[model samples]
Target: MCPLFSPPLFMQRYQFVVDFVQAHGSKKVLDLGCAECSLLKQLQYHGKGVELLVGVDKDSSSMKTRMHSFAPLSSDYLQPREGPLEIELYQGNVTQPDPITRGFDLITCIELIEHMQLEDVERFSEVLFGFMAPSAVIVSTPNADYNPLLPGLVGFRHPDHKFEWSRQEFQLWAVRLSELFGYSVSITGVGALDDAHTDVGFCSQIAVFNRKPSQNDPTNQHRSRGEPTVYRLLYSVAYPSLSDNNVLQRMLVNEVLSQAEQVKAAWLSGEWAAKMAGAREPYRQGGDICVSLLDVWACPQVKHLCGTLRRFTEALVGERRVPLTPDRQAVIVPTEEEDEEELDEEEEDEEEMAAVEARCTTTTTSVATEDWEEEITHSAVGELTACHVLAHD
Candidate 1:
């Protein structure tokens, strides 16, 4: 890794795969589920010395667009001095072998397995290990056990994921597959690993399988002459910086502040007043107002606002100055037992409130009167303070 140019953690994983391929002196390489061919681009940019680079994916549209966009950016670095790099794009399924020229030096299926059904994984493994007969195969998937470490994240990382495997589940599958095929498998991890005992720590798990010498020999009975259907050519260009965390962070902050200002204007424009006037007795107990405010906080227009939401909640909590309920005007400290129960309930409520606000913040373009604008600012402060008081009780 370059000290001056730090790629994001996910990109680092792709780099790791490339490094492993280069270290083993692999020349012919193939990537399965190569969406946007980002990894291939990175490999070329990093000068991995791959003579032939092939990428296959089910998404024909994206591949076509990427190929067109990146053609101008493709440089001499992607081509070897001895000969031009043979870059190929194919649309194919992993479960079934296609007419792709076999006997690759290295094959990679990074973050592609979890999209498959367990049965499909079995078929894919057979096709890869038996037919492809690469010297080395690298596969990566999410470690479900590490999900707890991500704040406010729930279920799978992506909705398209069929299922995520824990470390034990992944290892068990790898061992079984290695036994079925004539290969030796090693396991390693990617992404941050903090607190090893309690968490799997690494966000993604990887398996590297090296074929037995006899298995790689051309005389082996496992070798197959299947060819993959020629896939449509997409962009074969230099890797572009797809994303920057710092730039995204700045954009999110600016967007959140802008939305907040819009919210302030909406509040001053009597939007809340109109809703409050129509509310039933139960809804008038600040529940509707809390929901309304949270709707503003959770708008999807702002990107990566989980940390921002936490900060906003903390600020509101710190500025709390009034009681939550109108009837309970006086502050009354509770006994230890009561305090414990109240604390638990408060924590649950706070989490719920945060989730609601984080997912539902609405935007409005209505103008505000000067007097109402001042009142709305003060009212927002008071409401947030009251919500904080409710959460602390």
Candidate 2:
């Protein structure tokens, strides 16, 4: 028997929700019936502008076991969150009214309503649309219309599912609830079949409900009514971010210095190669090369620079060790060995002066001085190791 879908039905469902949340720029989001917290994990990484995320489920043990997955990783510290993010998981019944979950920008109930009893489904509708009324809501359930296509499949998709609704049945229920609660509803689906089986609709049906304002609605009274907390907090995490001034500066300085060193090392290698080939020095100064800002950004090691390009460039320039041209497009990198070379040249000049003062210099002084300068040049070039150039046009 073949698997139901190529990319898998669960992944498609999560992608659909992620796209919607990101496009809408929803700040506060709640996921109802968030089993194993799979959807929550995806949103934390992919959902833009989502500051607060909450998950509600009845399974406490599973949530606790999976909580460790949300911890900060090494990459997370390297590239901290753009803004503050908090994720909280609660163990509670969806049918019950909770004041804490009110005024959310978005709420998702993926494949959840089908598992509750018929009575509980009604209670959940009232709780979600009336008391916990959010700006928008998303619900998904198994499509009974597509069941016949599955080989040897009988009844609902899962044993826990109380009822699987056909396309017409799900639409009718959604439309009725929307009218009663002062909301607009739209129906869509995921996990589609081939053109031949298009009439059967999708394996999973989705309904998106958006609340509408009313002059005098009974549900409006529940807005101010404070209800006691019923859901037990299972797990909570406040993500680390670069919002801290100290953290931002510290990380920025480290990366700038690291890139500067790499650029300087590359400059030294090229100068040494040119010298060995009997060509004039490739670099203008003592192994110092000029690199464009674009060249610095192109390096794979600098790809993790956390903030905007302009902001990061400003921080890079502020490092003091990295000196940029007046145009700010390129930086002049001086080789580490250049300082030693300058000291050597000064010492040589001082010795030559001392010999002349002694009046013991012969007619061969000019040739001998030339030979000594060549020896010093060779010593500096031989010490350099080969490195790849980070500079580009």
Candidate 3:
């Protein structure tokens, strides 16, 4: 079997993994539940300046790998990374509230929730919010509906995973948590799943979350009203640079996506929908995770492997940040020849029209603020209205 099937020391919800590194400026990422610290290593280049990759896990043996055991929760550099990284490995349960978690722009939790009891997740998410800045987290888990037992391919199954949730079940929790905590949630996929058949332990999401909202939001009345299929794809495809200018790029990308059918009906063909449909809409669970395919595709490396699909992902990312003009139209070219033609077309169009494209931040970005309002008005509003009466459990 190819090594690609080999899971990381810890399961990584890939979509979130990218966004967290990209959004948090890559400098101060807290890799909670990090297994081998390999994932943290992958993120090393993305860090901008004060970049620090902190990997936390309870396994003492993980300490031996290429990282330093995080110094006990202290302001000083806990195990500094051997390279430019300031990676820290700590013997602690990220699920529990710790002062060390704060100041981070992004957080990652991939397939770790299944190992914890439901009651533990309830408290864990609570603690999770405490450690993060108001924006940006990426998480993923199995879609229970597909597996009925656990999502994702089998064989990695562990006795510890408590109750694997269906896509719906996970989202129920995610939506509630977003409402309660004031974060925006989006989702992506770690690996593709079979919709016609079922696979046990099949991965469901590459969920992303941002505690703080982008200043330029995407919530026009029309934003959330679309057929969610394309939007989920759009979100992932444009994520890496979308946070530029504080997700001004992300919002603009969604804005274009909102009107993509106008660009061409073929882009929205039934075959396309069938291939890209989500097991769940906005697939974020407990409302704290967000998704972006650009985040998925923007490996700063993986683009080569995904090939033409990579270009589709890149074009999607560019469309969001590049401002449209009264005269300019986004050309769709599904072929290599068309791509060359489009570049030629862009130059001709560039001189003819005024570029009103949005200004994006250079730092890694969280989700847009409009999604914040959507979470509030749609799901969060009702959930927030619920009185915080203590649960009997």
Candidate 4:
């Protein structure tokens, strides 16, 4: 009755979801788009051990199924029931703002995304994220490449489907999400579900979003300003400088702040016509920076990244984490790590090939962890808010 996630590879994911919710030791689960309420039944059937099971769907037919049973937990919070387990199923669409009754330990939206309207995707995503029980959200969706091999075979393939994504496409989004929202993401599983009748294999992609712990600059050990918010991306936390010792490098450019102020004031005062003697330096001097984040947390990008992470940390403390930056107005600051000496078009291509070869040599190489880089004790609080695109240039 729970998810027939019958595949051998997926058993790991089930264990993952179970262990994830048990971290905080709460027993409430809400399944959005709970079609046929199979997930609820599974919890009731298998989760006689699970804390709470709540299922929701928009189709009225979902109520006719044997899984629908509700008991009042209070006037507003009602415990659901199914078989020997306490389960609940509400016939309502996830698109509505008020469909969910309360927060849950883990919120799951599995394989049902393809059927929703393209525009509603973001809206409902936020709504669903709001329903997350403050721990983690486990999501599984179709890898766009897993499209039907024969289009007209079954009703499963819809011509009006909005868009699809490949592995890289999903990673790009995940990277951006983590960067923008300060959430940690890891791909949990990738598998193919075969619809033999259509000769098509639906590729399932799963990702886990875990909150990390809060940390502060060892320098500012006692101050509690909460986290800093970069209302607007003013700078890149890029390589501040390319030097052998990162601290020395940061100190060397300690003058950049004062110097940049003069430059910005000049540029902002309609005095762009006049150039300062120090303004001779070109934009974005690219390179490497070897500073450890523990001691100094003053750079704009560093501040933004860490501050956001702190908020997440404060939110999910003690929840459990296996463990695991920012923007620019327009100034392009380049760093030395990437400034590996550019080559002409042909030479550049060769360099890339050699880099790839070197990469292959160290493919399985691992590094020794320093004391500070050991197991984490802090936790982060974050929700997988799909994409908060406030502006585009």
Worst 10 residues of 1 by lDDT: 365-374
TM-score of each: 0.54, 0.65, 0.44, 0.41
Candidate 2 residue-wise lDDT, 268-296, digit = tens: 56532221222232234445566655556
Candidate with the greatest TM-score versus the true structure: 2
* Model 4 alpha-carbon drift over 4 Å, by segment: 1-26, 68-85, 99-101, 130-133, 148-161, 178-182, 190-202, 213-393
- What lDDT is reached at residue 390 by model 4? 14
Residues 285-379, candidate 4: write the lDDT tens digits: 23322211121222453343325535423322332110101221112222322333432543654564344223211111000111111111222
Candidate 1, superposed: residue stretches over 4 Å from native: 1-7, 69-83, 193-199, 215-227, 230-393
TM-score of 1: 0.54
Q: Candidate 4 has what TM-score?
A: 0.41
Question: What order do candidates take by TM-score, descending?
Answer: 2, 1, 3, 4
lDDT of 1 at 109: 87
Q: Which stretches of candidate 3 lie over 4 Å from their true place?
A: 1-16, 23-26, 45-50, 68-84, 131-134, 148-156, 193-202, 213-393
Residues 1-393 of candidate 3: C-alpha lDDT, one tens digit per residue: 112222421233443465556554544566666666555655654344434555666554554444432221221112212233334445566666554555565676755777687888888888776434434666666565543332233532344557767666777787777777767776555433345443433445445666645463322112122222211110111112222332333333434333332222433342222113331111222322222343333332224323454454445544533433222323221322335665776576444322211111111110001101111111434322112111100
Q: Which window of 10 residues has the lowest lDDT sum in candidate 3?
A: 365-374
The true-versus-predicted C-alpha distance at residue 390 of model 1, in Å, is 36
Any runs in candidate 2 off by more than 4 Å, and if so which? 213-228, 256-393
Could you give the candidate ranking by lDDT, starting with the highest?
Answer: 2, 1, 3, 4
